[model samples]
Target: TDIPHFSTTDWTWAKGALQTVDRPYGPLLNLLHHGIGSTHVCHHINPRIPHYNAWYASALLKNNFPDLVRYDSTPIHKALWRIATRCTVVSQRGGIDGYFYQPKPSI
Candidate 1:
């Protein structure tokens, strides 16, 4: 299934949402910022938080750490295209644990 991309800055929410709602042929990816996707921010902060209560937990975090928590409103299809075209290389930086995508330099 094709997944929606939110932003180039951070794709944690998008990835998690895709994993959670992904289905055969096509996914129900339109349910953005809801269900597992909405609670993704909270999940990263506290893995122990259950999915049922993630939305509430996320709201709290959003109020406290506005800078740290990012919610990209970009449509998934656009973000996916941007990522696919720009994020061409996957390599580690600083150390093995620090992996990232690097765009190909313009000719």
Candidate 2:
């Protein structure tokens, strides 16, 4: 199922929601902040949180948004976990300034 996949827009939405004031799933966000790393790392250790909002969106589609206790069991979540696990290699020497993206040069 090519469920539209996730895009940059989806990432924006997740970022916005993560910074919201509600703080319903605060711990999850914290875990993502502390446990997860860059997109490349997440792509291997676990791309779940990266695509976390997608599952949220999915639940909303099924009218089970509020019922979604967590996303740890979802495929997207597992994929993200795997990505994160593999991305973090201490032996790998590289810059952490922006592993997943680069900021545009200032004008």
Candidate 3:
């Protein structure tokens, strides 16, 4: 299957709660959990920290290792649309060992 990949929106309380639940529950809970949205990357890096403190940890990571961290500042809706429309295929080219995807080339 061709899965779409895009940057995650900033973590907020509503976003964090939504991440804890399944996708179907997102729309209803996103606003309420928006604060937790951005700390996702931090959580993945260090699960020991509680969600409430993930944001602070994420900030430290971003500051210390900006290039290493995959922090996306895009708005959630816009990032979704961009991925849906542009990321159509996944491929691994020669010399590139890992699987990855890119947007379709412009005309």
Best by TM-score: 3
lDDT of 1 by residue, 1-51 (tens): 223333445456535432322111213642443455545556666678876
lDDT of each: 0.54, 0.34, 0.54
Candidate ordering by lDDT (highest first): 1, 3, 2
* Candidate 2 residue spans exceeding 4 A from truth: 1-14, 18-77, 89-107
Query: How well is each residue in 7-80 modelled by candidate 3, as lDDT tens digits?
Result: 25434443343232112214434446744555655665666887667657877877996755554555656666
Query: For every model shown, what is its TM-score relative to the native structure?
Result: 0.53, 0.17, 0.59
**What is the Cα-based lDDT of residue 88 in candidate 3?**
65
Tell me the TM-score of model 1. 0.53
How much lDDT does candidate 1 score? 0.54
Query: Which regions of candidate 1 fall more than 4 Å away from where they truly are?
Result: 1-34, 90-100
**Which consecutive 10 residues in model 3 have the weakest lDDT in total?**
16-25
The predicted structure with the larger TM-score, 1 or 2, is: 1
lDDT of 2 by residue, 1-107 (tens): 10122244444544433321111234565466542322222223224554544444444533643332223333445545555554332221254211232223355
| Candidate 1 residue 95 C-alpha distance from true site, Å | 14
Model 3, residue 99: C-alpha shift (Å) = 1.5
